[model samples]
Target: MSASTPIARSKSAALARILDNVPKGYHRYTCGTVAARKAEALAQKFHTLYGIGCSPAQRLIRKGKGLANVVLVMHWPVDAEKVEWLLLATDGKGLETETLRDVGDKQRLKWLGYELARHTNRAKVMWTWRRTKEEMTELHALIAMQANQHNTAAISETLERIARQPGFRGVRTQSWALCEAALQRGYDGPLPHLYFVQKTNHGERLALD
Candidate 1:
């Protein structure tokens, strides 16, 4: 047998073992449909990559398809305060225009991803193209502050910088409702999972793979 075959089998067996030992009375949360599907996909990826089961206990909760929301019940401990702190920290800084201009570079993406991963244990991230113009501007300023303390550029400088970037130049408003949603629940991280989702949609999932 090939070396990978045994490793794959071992991972599958470990998942089975984890499922068999699921605990009783696990609480389920409505994470929305897209979030739920994405979460499951992430869980599967984690199993394949690390052979780690997401939950130690299983509880049969309602399962629905074609629904806009996906729900899950996990038995792991959640640190709400920690999540909030992380989210606030991430939202406080916006990427510099120079950084955004270089976003097309492979090295930059990897560097940013590495920086983000150090703050959380999550393996994937998602990015949504759904922010209003005002919201996007505010987010950019916040990210800028987080990225640098001496970015004393005037509004015109910032606007000019943003205007020079091709992808974001015309996107006067980008949707950040997802970020707001995550913040509502006190989640904090650099949104690596959102980045993963964007790459997936662009057929660049292989980059992450």
Candidate 2:
């Protein structure tokens, strides 16, 4: 089914809801101050990586078996209407940057294989002896280019830029720049020097820098 369809949207939303509650000790990647559209985009990414059919019980089984990594996309309420703090949950044992890279790579390879097999060698009849390998080599380069766009540095820069956009407010935290602002309401410790931008002087703000 197309991702744009209503049923597909519902399934994606359902999958995201299930992920809201996950096993303890999962790592978090916070994409702070997410609008509904951006949250949906992130949820679609998770849905693409892990199929929407996964259940909490099955997630536990997969984690136990070491056959699959548990992943979740979650959002918490923000003062702004129709926006939230989007966070990603994954196996906490590894670095968050590496986990994101690994997930992106696996998805790319899976799509590449499917496309090469489907387009160049339909019916599995081996239309050409070496066509599949040749196509794969060509496609791999394109995948590499796409992969570069999502590296740690690039993604961090993107998130930083997003944080500075109008409407986001609150003080930055020590753990990570994006998450601290979101968690400041409950955090009792000292806050950092960064803060998000507000377009106008009309809204309920957690704090001002």
User: Against the hidden reference, what TM-scores do the models get?
Assistant: 0.18, 0.27
Can you list the residue pairs that collide in candidate 2? none
What stretches of model 2 exceed 4 Å from their correct place?
1-23, 50-53, 65-82, 88-209
Error of 2 at 130 (Å): 62
TM-score of 2: 0.27
Lowest-sum lDDT 10-residue window in model 1: 82-91
User: Candidate 1 lDDT, tens digit per residue, 60-138?
Assistant: 1111221111112121112211110000001111212111212223332111011111111166332212224455657
With candidate 2 superimposed using the best TM-score fit, by how many Å does residue 156's alpha carbon deviate from the native?
Answer: 43
Task: Name the lDDT of candidate 2.
Answer: 0.34
Tell me the alpha-carbon RMSD of every candidate.
Answer: 19.9, 20.7
